[model samples]
Target: MVRSDSAGNGGDAMKEHCGVLAIYSMENRPVAERIVKGLAALQHRGQESWGIAVPGEPILKGLGLIGQGADANAKKILSFTSNRGIGHVRYSTRGRTTLENAHPLDIRGEFAIAQNGTIANTEDLESVVEKEFPILGSTTDTKLAGYRLLQHYRAEHDWTRAFHKLSKELSGSYSFVMITHDGEVLAARDEAGYRPLCLGYDPDTDTHIVASESCALTALHADLVRDVQPGELVSLTKDGLKITKFAAASRHYHCPFEYTYFGHPSSKIDDHYVYNARRKLGRVLARKYPFKADVVIPVPDSARPAALGYSEESGIPMEEGLMKDRYRRKGSLRSFIEPTAKSREEIVREIITIKPVVDGKDVIVVDDSIVRGTSSRNIVQSLRDAGAKKVYMVVTFPPIRHPCYMGIDFPTREELLANKADGETLNVTDLNSKVAREIGVDGLGYNDINGLSEGIGLGKDEMCFACVTGEYLGLKKDPVLRTREEMKA
Candidate 1:
């Protein structure tokens, strides 16, 4: 287990939840190898710790990148002869970044559990257990939820019934996968579907896989069967998959941020291709906030597709005006998830401004979204230093005016630029101008809520715009941001 005494702030922008994967092999073959691959593919969702659990063996877990973390137990984990097991890679939205808070947590030696998304009512979930069970102290929210389910399983002696009980009582978002001591795999998505979970199959190995994204499934060469429906539970055995709906999805509240920035462009979520959605987002921005520029540029990496769409729609040639310092070991790391302002700045500074492309040109820089204006400020200043005549910003997602509790980190309103405006009542135009000034850009235009929905090609009501609209669909009650000291008490 990896231990850290303290962790930095979760960057200056939006950080996401963990990634989860479960695999079952009919032939009882070594599944860890494939699970590792799938988890590696999903590593962008998390970088703190990686864990895997199989029946009749002690679960293996490590900290940092999966490849380096798994070095010591590589052979042992790789040789595990198990037919079914669950794996997780974590980027904590709850608790501290410590081994004790890692996922695939063992539950009373009878089961192991891991999940994606926050349990807004995690404190309340603990009430069902007997006092003798001890308070779920010094553990993450995942453990709180798992223990809650354990109480039900102990009474009913059935995973299905336990899940039914959990789904009914639990609040907030999750896509849970658990490994039973009996070597069966169970997967579920919360009713609101604030997170993505998909079912995939590997025909050659006769394996059933459940993962957080289609990219991970594609990495394993597994065919994506479909996304697990909201409020649905799937039980996987050698026989096949058994699906049960524990609740009704009267209205689905999928996260729009997934398509805009959090999701891998190659992945598909909720029946929409992420890459296509991103292109549409750029086109929408071009149409809504048409600006004449000598050339178009993207903020590297995630914004590349959006930049392409902007160029196509505006008839302006797109150029790689910014390039990541790929040669450096830390250069390729994502700045948005760096966990500290200093660290995020270090990574963002590594993004070199391609002077030849933007020098003396009126540049339109396309980005996925602006969280607190930290990285955007850095990028815009770099363009000025590189002799760019003008820099205009186009963001795919709307201004994140409200903190997100369902998932997609940045839990406090104070850290949000839109929310931090002089007053809370400024409209989009004034808010954009204020933010543009803060970020040192000539001008800025943000995709509105309606534009965001249209870009993703999903109905506004069917998506969670809570981060922008402040209307939560999955929260049972208004969430309170608890202090760590208070939580420890």
Candidate 2:
């Protein structure tokens, strides 16, 4: 429903959910610039709007890239002298794209919150507030949650107790970082573990960092500490880090897509290399769904590593099928930003170009995942028009059936193609049978969930598969959207 006219063709140009970065320094050293650079390392996750929360000052946020210009906003943020700070880059999933929805959301006298996942029960929570406290701003569920936290703290006057109480009542996936007026920095991960959060430390400076991925820490020359366990709350203060368990810890469900697409290449997730995991996915796809192809071509950035693995395992030559314009602005143009469906179709054509090596030969196209099937459809059609003898579509991960509430910009069941079809009928069963009926290829295949986890060197129990499995780990109630059908009066 949201539309824009710009056309984005870069590798990292797609929609990301959000990214969070927080730092606690023991030496009171200047870290705003370092924080900004560290966030630049995580810019791949979200680019729509960015903000930094500094102690004893107003939160700084605006619409632009992090490492650009010497403007007032940048000067204001860089000038802030704080030993502790939090930064956020957001991609709107629950709320509209506006300055109000931008994170590091502050409740004047109470707390400033920066979040990285969707609050699934936002509507229900908002309903509770509409019936209880006086409403403040827009209909965004994020602000609603912030208000609830503030209201709870005001009544209880205990930050820890209020956080625990509110965590119990909220439903959906979220990893939150909050700074209280009392100078305590609190971080909490969702029980489902739908999103990734980790802690790292710079022993040299005695500074601790929390970010969406391990790569950010590496960029800041910080040592990798343990991941923030699900259902656990970590508080960073002058006395050092103190962790407390709130809700019963659920089975860890690290989103499988993180390795395949979202995470940076150099990053290590759950002790596994993201690039290596993707390559293993390719290898698994080749073994599970072996297809005779003359050459393997990746869909672009996210699929490149996996495609190489497929080529290595299958002994097929890998070719650079599509070229990306790296200079493209991060948030300026996007495939989904096309104003109309026809324009969206045309934008894909202008962006991708097939190599001449595929002419009169079978081609295997590897992509990270397919949500609505529109992008895949167009890619296949373009490859066919390039004179390929046959086009086979291979996705690195299994079909994404359930909408992701933990973050990743996948909202509403109506937009998911897998949700409409049963598992048995999916391409993995009869690749040719389904591909003949579907657009863009003679066959389509995907890596099995188990195979993907194995390839990543982790067990299903350790990673988040809720987007693929629909089995949320911790919350007792379903998301507000899912419960809407049953809520009818």
Candidate 3:
């Protein structure tokens, strides 16, 4: 997610969003250790906290890396020996990063839920839930969802009916996985399809895996199945996979950012490969804004594919000019994790060490996106510090000029560099010039929105370009749907 306030090791340039995973095996085998491994693979989604919930065992959750906490306590989780479970890694787009805000949140110990995306009407819903239920343990939207589901189940002892009622009352992006006391795993995505969830099968163990990314299924050696259709629910039972549509929409607005930066490159969402899309984005950007540079260097891991595509298309030599330090504490581990304009500048100063590869050369620095401009600015400054003659910036995605209300953490327009002109989205060239001046770069170019959509091989109607275009699909026009400013008010 595009969190500007959170900081991390090299203060993370942006939030990693959240990851959700679940498994239901016909063999009735213990899945705690496997779930731990899957969570470790998905650590990039969110590092603030990790958690899991099985039918019979106590919920395992805590702050920090998943391997350190959940994996160490795998034995305790295995005592339940249930065949079905669900897990989540969170970065807190809605609530504070605390143990209470962790996912797989229990509902009176009857049902547990892990979800990605925000409920736009959280304040109103929270108020309603407070009157019917006990005071909530935490203020997270996901916890609220669990309680709301509880209210529905008690009124009508049917899970599907409860979910249908819940869907009607909530508005916004969500991909949810819920596990009941009966060992059934039910996964659903919101009508808009803003976040991702997919269903995969493991024939070897006769298991069905429902997760936020196909990469999680791949990590567990499961074959790729189609994505969980938007507004549809999939139930994994001993009787097999049951699919139903709880809500209906004429279109699906998949988050384009998923293909650009949010997803693991190995995962396929909606049949589009993320790595290929990024590489194609670079190719498109190079064609649109060709630069005369001696070499191209990536910002590191996430930008590597785009950098390679740029080098391939532009015929510039690609070099690894900066090194990423892998052993850094991420998420809400320290105060630095709460980023400010100053902290973002300091993070790039420490996290990436510059090599002499670009010395005496006009270098092109390729990054996936420029959220707040502080990290990009620091990167350009670092290159200058390393004796680079000139630095040009090539950003793959268009400028994020609007705060994402769906799920990404850039909740305020002021936090976005491109949205700084009294809430105006600047022209592409104007935005680039402004960012270039701030980052100390000789020149800057960004992929146009059309170019980005084309590179991802999807039409504008299929993806959520809300961050770039200042338009929110599937959102109701209401006062309760908040940006950071509204929330403060």
RMSD of each: 3.7, 6.0, 5.3
Clashes of 2: 4
Residue-by-residue lDDT tens digits, candidate 2, 1-489: 111111211121112357888888888887777778788888777766777777777766765456552154676766877888788877654323555556677764467778887666665666666666554523445556777877788789866677677888777667888777766778888766767888899999999898889999999999988888777788888999888876655466677878888888788876778999999899998998799999999977788899999999999999987655455432133444232346445546554556596778899989888776677787787777778889887888787777666676665565666655454345566533454345557888867778888788888777767667776664557654543233211
The candidates, ranked best first by lDDT, are 1, 3, 2
Question: Candidate 3 on 76-141: residue-level lDDT in tens?
Answer: 765757788889987764334666567767766677788888776666667778888745532567
The list of candidate 1 runs beyond 4 A from truth reads 1-16, 130-132, 481-489
TM-score, every prediction: 0.94, 0.87, 0.91
Worst 10-residue lDDT window, candidate 2: 1-10
**For this target, which candidate reaches the highest TM-score against the unseen true structure?**
1
Residue-level lDDT of model 1, residues 80-179, one tens digit each, is: 8777788898876433466655677777666788889887775575555535366444345666777788888888887767777887777778999998
Give candidate 2 misplaced runs (Cα > 4 Å).
Answer: 1-16, 68-72, 130-132, 155-158, 328-350, 420-427, 469-474, 482-489
Which candidate leads the pack in lDDT?
A: 1
Per-residue error (Å), model 3, residue 424: 2.2
